[model samples]
Target chain A: MKKFAIGFYVAVTIALMIWGYYQAIYVAPDEQTMHEAQRIFYYHVPSAMVAFLFFAISLIGSIGFLSFRRNRPDWAQASDAWALAGAEVGVVFCTVVLITGPLWGRRAWGIWWTWDARLTTTLVLWLIYVSYLLLRRFAAGPQVQTLAAVLGIFGALDVPIVYMSNRWWRTQHPAPVFGGGDDSGIKDPTMLAAFGWNVLAWLAWGLLILGLRYAVERQHQKYAAQEAQEALNEVA
Target chain B: MTSALWTHLVKDLRIEWRSREAINSMLFFALLVVVLFSLAFDPRGAFSQEIAGGVLCVATMFASVSALNQAWAREIRHQVLDAQRMAPTSGAELFLAKVLANFLFVSIVQLLLAPVFLVFYNLRVEGNAWLLAVVLPLGTWALVANGTFFAALSIRTRNRELLLPLILFPIFMPALLAMVLATTSILTGDNDPTLWIKLLAGYDIIFTTVSLLLFDVVLHAE
Candidate 1:
């Protein structure tokens, strides 16, 4: 059954990607101002949203891990697994966002990069999570999990402050195109359709990746537990 | 709790006075940073005034990191932290005491650096001196509180010197931003520090409360 599910997921992801490519290339109307360069938005924006979503998941997992360890120690491993999975997946999507963002900017703004609020905040968010992963990897001993969880919570809390500070400092990036105001958003239904389909496809991809990562984490935890039990038995 | 805090604070100060390790190094590091900044840019140039805020804060941050790194290292070195673990005082009180001691040490370093920063950067404070005064201590508290907390967290890690800054800097970015901005306004004679001051105060209060509450969890780990 698990193999079948894996097969189904792979097949569905391929199909969705193919459809999204077609819609972005052929179906979506050319944006009046940016023309062809604007097509990158269909990937860039959704990737960023997915990245933020994963970070939020990691935040929830971190909180769950800490609270569970404090109040119900039996369930702490599961929470730790979730936190690890969420952080790893979040980093992947954030990398996608960072890459696609510069490519999009080179085309849209005629510059490779800008210190805009959103851009700087996204970069800082990536750094925070990377440090989170590093802490987990290097901080050895029994307390590593708790330390990483604490760092995760701190990183999660900093995200909003980062965004707010950058916004107040300066903003060279374009105003939001959707829900920004009456002055923005797509007027063409085809453009909206393409955007909606691509967002759904990316969300589906993110969930599939997260599921696989979580399974791997759980397997690793199981192996570690078995090894420790065997060692205890040998000592006895 | 207050007595516990006072006792720990005095103990840390006495240790520092005897050895003169952390603060002296921190001060020299701050001075070197200022000197490096002066070498990199012309101090009397028009551009220096514009960047003076960033220069001063970055130097202070680097110095504070060194100080914080030493703050936990000494305790962990002699197994003093292990003894403290058995003390009757709550973890919050002990954590608060360390934070207060670190705050005092970092503030003194900053106080010494300020005059040097003015001379090295050729900066003149055009805005209210009172505003500068408020911004300095509030910003220092914001840095020291989080620095002390993360220092304790990172002490157990291998290569803690690298990990401390890695964990602290991202968390410190927002407060640093507010501090630099408020200082810039003061030095540039902008005269409106209300927003930045509020940000600094808010950050200090929130982190101090959160750190005090969560410090016990950090101590109980392992």
Candidate 2:
């Protein structure tokens, strides 16, 4: 049942992504300041949302690991795999946010980059998760896994601080107003619909990737256990 | 109850006094950081309160890191943590003792640096220097409290010296930010000290409480 649901979800997600891309190209707003290339927001935003979700999942897994021992490795591993999957997609999206943000900034704000809150925080978060993955490479065994889980939990704690820091710093150093309308930046109803669909599509893709990754991890664990058993038999 | 706490505390202090290399190295490194900052920046630029804010921020981070590493290094090197765990004291007592030791150790460095920082930076401490008195103790408590916890956990790892900062810094950023802002304001004579002070108090309370709660699971993980 879980597999069926995941498969259906994957199928619908791929369909939605195709639709999202088509809509983005044909129906979405033509960038007044950023040219047609600014349509990358649909993909970029969804990827970021998924990435954040992954971090959240990683935190939840860490909490579980900390709370329950010996009986929770399966759940822990599943969560770990999903978190890693989400991070993988997130990095891709962060790349998109990074590449497109500067372009948008140059076109709209007339600067390549301003070290604004969102950009800086997002970049820092990207570096952080990248390190989180690197740390996992050195961490092995149940003990190390739990330790990495603790690190993952603490690392995700930075997300809120990063966001708040950005908000505080941005307000402290206000940027000059370039665009005429309200700066909340959510202007159109159609744009909102497209954005919502884009988010949905990206979330579906994120789950799909995580499901695949979990299966692979389970197989790896199985092989590892088999190898250990064979080694024990040889010793006997 | 109070005697039990004090007993554990005295024991830790005695243990630390026996091997004082960690504290000595930490003090040296922290002062060196400030001197490096002074040399790296032009003297006029370095002495100003604005630059002092940045230096103070970096100083606390370095001091905290040094003390944390030392605190854990002693435990791991001596293989004393497990024995310490097997002692009559609870994990809570152990945690509190370590954090207090960390607090004392870092505060000693802070005390040493204060006079030098004051003279070098020409800091006046005009509005409520009492606030500085309150902030340093509380600020160092928060920094060292969290640092000691992370350090304890990191010591169990293969490469503690590297992993400790990666684990501690991000979690401690909020406290560090509040400390820097509060210290900066006090140094720079910013009038609105209310919010930043409250933030420092809040950070100290929240981190200390959380670390104490999690100390058992963290220590016994091995």
Candidate 3:
């Protein structure tokens, strides 16, 4: 299983790297409004989508852990590792979105950043994941895992409400040059196809990262158990 | 069932009454939160109805979290949960007793401050102040139900105080939104205050019901 994961990771990295390069160079038209800088959306949007997908999976794994409560500690740990890796990638994507988003906003809306819906929710989501990682570091053992699992489940539930309330509030209380308007002229077929391909590439990258992280977590758990056994033997 | 329920609540009250430590600390903590909030947004802004409403909601939440952490943390630290499990009380009775105790504490804070908030904010609350009496219990029910279960989960972990908010902020968003919107509308005197009230009531029902059903699984999860 580990070998298969490693092989798959190498193949996916090569494929995505090539596809990303191709999309950037050959396709994805130069932005008429913001010129070339708008191209970052190709990577940024895909990263956010993939990260959210992994977060959803983490919730599923948690529910499974709660219901089953077997010797499947590895599965629980794997899910945690997947979530961490996804957040790592998502944060990078969010960073690009945060940086280039403001740049794009400055060009289009005449402000570096606006306290608008998408921006605020994204920022909050970033904080939640940071806290999630911190919680894992602070808490360990079965009880800690259960607490983190409950947290993961609840945190995922918050995402939609956060998005909805922000949208509602933004519409009601408008921010300068931010709220009110969706001004994409047309959804060109080529751009749509490019986006589809990029999303696929991003999903592939997410799988590889999750797999690598899962392997590392499993090894760490095994090593910890071995040390405990050695300590018990020494005591005996 | 009634006797079991009575037993749980009576035992808890007896234990709490003996120490009075938990309740004292919780009350002080709630007061500290309110004062800090007032200071945090003062001079530049007096505690208007809007500010008062927001502060009251947040302070209640913080106080509930602080108190719930102590309630369940003490149980695990002392292995009282095992003793309770072996007692003649059912899980439901135990749950109900915890909920009642938490509700009583939170309500005391809310009641004591209700008039003070009105006076400080320079506003008259009309159209059934009794309505809030109904709303507070329902809201407290939801918060305490989930708060107890999460508190149980957090008891043995390190940095539990930090973990509680991280896990809670998301679960409590719906309640927070409902409470704020309902309270704001009530203060502003909307023609259809029923809408926000119904939303708050619905949130309370949904969360409390879900938490009650899940409390058994949580209590035994370890």
Model 3 sits at a Cα RMSD from the real structure of: 4.4
What's the candidate order when arranged by decreasing TM-score? 1, 2, 3
A47: Cα error in model 2, Å = 2.3
Per-candidate TM-scores read 0.97, 0.86, 0.82
Q: What is the lDDT of residue A214 in candidate 3?
A: 64
**Full-model lDDT, candidate 1:** 0.87
Q: CAPRI verdict on model 2?
A: acceptable
lDDT of each residue in B150-173, candidate 2, tens digit only: 888777777777877776766666
Give the candidate order by descending lDDT: 1, 2, 3
> Per-residue lDDT for B6-43 in model 3, tens only?
87778778878799765677667767787787667761
Off by over 4 Å in 3: A1-15, A31-37, A71-103, A110-127, A163-168, A171-186, A231-236, B17-24, B43-47, B85-92, B126-131, B190-196
- Candidate 1, which segments miss by more than 4 Å at Cα? none
lDDT of 2 by residue, A74-140 (tens): 6766665555555555666667667767775665667877766677677777776766665666555
How does each model score on lDDT? Answer: 0.87, 0.71, 0.66
How far is each candidate from the true structure, as Cα RMSD in Å? 1.4, 3.9, 4.4
- Candidate maximizing TM-score: 1
